[model samples]
Target chain A: MHIPSWLLTFCEYLEQTASLVVLLPLGLAFWRWPRLPKTMRLMTVYLVFTELVLLASSLVELYRPAWSYGIWHFFTLVQTLLFFRIYYLTLSSPAVRLLIQFAAVGFTVFAFLDSLYLEGLQQVNSYTHVAQSALLIGLALLYFEQLLNELHITRLEQDPLFLVSTAVVLYFSGTVLLYVFVNKLSAPADYASHQVIYTLNSMVNLVQYLLFALAFWYAGRTLPSQSRP
Target chain B: MNSWLLPVMLATPVLLLLALGIVGFVLRYQRRLLRQQEQLRQVRDASQQQALEAALLAQEDERRRIAADLHDGVGTTLAIAKLHLSTLGQPNLTEEATALLDQAIGEVRRISRNLLPAALQKFGLPFALDALARTVPADGPTHVIIEQRGQPRRLDPKRELIVFRVVQELLGNGLRHAHAETIEVSVDFGPDYLSLQYRDNGVGFDPAAGDLPPAPGTRSGLGLTNLRSRVAVLHGTLRHDSAPGAGSKVWISFPIPYLPADQKPALTTSV
Candidate 1:
């Protein structure tokens, strides 16, 4: 099925500009409330890395198309590590922490190997994307379970960690199928389908960033602390 | 399995593991919370017990002070007044004035004895109870009987006074409220504990209804509240057996700590 040209153009515009709109307030919130949990502060740093990579990749896509894949691959590697670190800090169980650590190390090694020998820097790193999405979805579900088990939470909407976990679960679940089928759909004949599928990805990205912004706003209202274990 | 089903199978186990992990975490967390709450309750109960003990001790000290004031301050003055009246020569004194002064002295002595029974400190609990039984006038409609079992042994003086006061209060309640004809007081000494029993043929009220006097500010059950508190202070139990139209029986027992050979009392056979 074909998407309307006007709506597609609008989605593209939102994809490009959503981060700036979301990040400005989120940055201000972090600046206003410096006592956010150590994990959240680290997440702010990861967000800065994401924005920088996005801008660099956009510029490279316009001028040097060949290098954009390399840039994207590198950013994926870093983002996976940062996501693992965030979960490691938030979770208290040693077994889960160990599982995440093993997954992070295994993914890093696999990505290194796939980039060098198989996909190289020119192809989409679909393997790493699929693995990362699946891992994140699982972690997000675990986080929700933990939150529910807590004896009390004053307001779930105001809980920054709850918002962050929701964003992760929603975005990763939305992209799991697209990442799994990326290689099959990369042929030039499938260009229109690719554009439509990626537009969905962009829309998911917009929601994810908005959720992050809301989480930061909640964080600004109070010091970031874990709910009862 | 279909090619598409491969990821589904892999993801299924991962999701299950995550759920199991969280359930385990919650169970451990809840157990920890229960233990903390249990510890908090025990601490609160211990502090409350300590406060009750302090209040009981303070009450006994205050009673001793008031009793001394009545005996030394009031009793001495009334005795002096009686002596002065006698000193007036027989020719100068009127029959009416002499009888009035004698009656005034007797009333003062009675009040002083009620405040703090001097017999409780001088002798032991059995002796004090006997003296109390004698106070119910023999001519009155009510008959008083005193009974003792096992060799009588002296307890700690303070404890003896507490037991005496409890009995005295019971007797007073019987005379004032219970229109009974027979009041029997008995003390039994065992190897490890002592028991005091009071049975009266009074118009017994319902124990369930708590017919005792109301405390000053609160409408708590029967006047046994004070008796209950004293018994608690002694680490003892107070049981009341009564029903409407049936005579009331109160039984109180206190554990006796082992006394040193030097502190043990010489045996006494009679009440």
Candidate 2:
């Protein structure tokens, strides 16, 4: 569990600067391309919301760690709901849309109950995190399948939804097992191991957000002419 | 779990997911390329079809103009000359001179008809085709037969001209190239289509080879190309079946267009 000092510093820097690196481009894109697809615009809003929650949670953690955990747990549930809405918009099938809606609602309820009764606000919400990651991974895979099935997209690289879905698949699949075991790495004795795990998680977050920036930029450049419902 | 196995286990799925993302992007890129290729093909085909239609329309216009000139200009002068010759009732006129003047008038009329047949515009397709069949020498090597299977229907004038030209080209090809003993031209008016079949027992050539050198004393095979272009303008199908030593058969089918009630009366009256 011995953590390297450089790794801890790198992780801290990533956590502190992620908002600027990720959210700035997305916000600028939203500003520039007011006519972007509804799903893309909502994604930018969700990302800004996530950054706000991260900033607020960090401040709360400095004062009271337990309260910060609660905020994060609530944020996780909100993020899942937002993602479900985004996927619901992109996907064409009614059956899949209904399934995602049901899963979103079910997961929100489960995360709430798990935070209150099972994992509690003091501990890491590892169970809900793992479940969210698993579900997002499934949705990402489904989005790719839908992409292939429809084959209507003329330029995949320029499609904001396609780019965001690719980022989701990569980041969620990479972090699913890590999140599942995050609680184990939370002990005071495992501080070093926790930092390492979190650092890896931060790296994944950085890559995911970079992809989001790319998607937003693509939308800003192309969405005015290519807007769809 | 072994400490070493931890990163390895984590890295495996991450790598796999990254690989999957790459594959998804590659697949999408390929799909985009295929879509672009198909679109390009469709555009090329559309332009080609447009060009063919324009050329065919211009050709039809030119033929009509020439037909009018031959009829009103040269034909009128020939009629006047004949009238003037007939009025000369003097004994000085030799029988040879009288017969020669009559022959010259007949030649002018025949040339005028060949340029644009008056029967085609005045009567309709069947009469025009019959007149076409009559042009073939009765005692010549080829015997031409015209047959109608179903009830004849008059089509739009433009479409009728297209069909007429197609048949004309096919018949001309058969007589000039096939060197066949018999040529049968059949017209069938189905409820949904107007079908024409031209069959001739001549020195047929392979249609797949396309535009092979004609036999001695025969012209090049440009008529079939023109025939195909004319058929395409009507959105029709033209099939040529032939082999060397066997006769050639050209089948042309054009869809029957739905005419408005007002147009139907004119077509029926014309028929």
Interface residue Cα RMSD of candidate 1 after superposition: 8.5
**Candidate 1: where are CA atoms >4 Å away?**
A1-229, B1-35, B91-95, B211-221, B264-271
Docking class of 2: incorrect
Task: Provide chain B TM-scores across all predictions.
Answer: 0.78, 0.82
Give residue A56's error in model 1 in angstroms: 59
**Which DockQ values do the candidates obtain, in the order shown?**
0.02, 0.07
Worst 10 residues of 1 chain A by lDDT: A220-229
Write one digit per residue (lDDT tens) for candidate 2, span B21-44.
665775666577557767887899
Task: Give the TM-scores of the predictions, in the order they appear.
Answer: 0.48, 0.55
TM-score of chain A of each: 0.87, 0.88
Worst window of 10 by summed lDDT in candidate 1 chain B:
B1-10
lDDT of each: 0.72, 0.75
- What digit string (tens of lDDT, one per residue) describes model 1 on residues B122-224? 7777788888988889999888887888877778766776677778777777776667899887888778788889898877777765765533422222657
Off by over 4 Å in 2: A1-4, A223-229, B1-5, B12-271
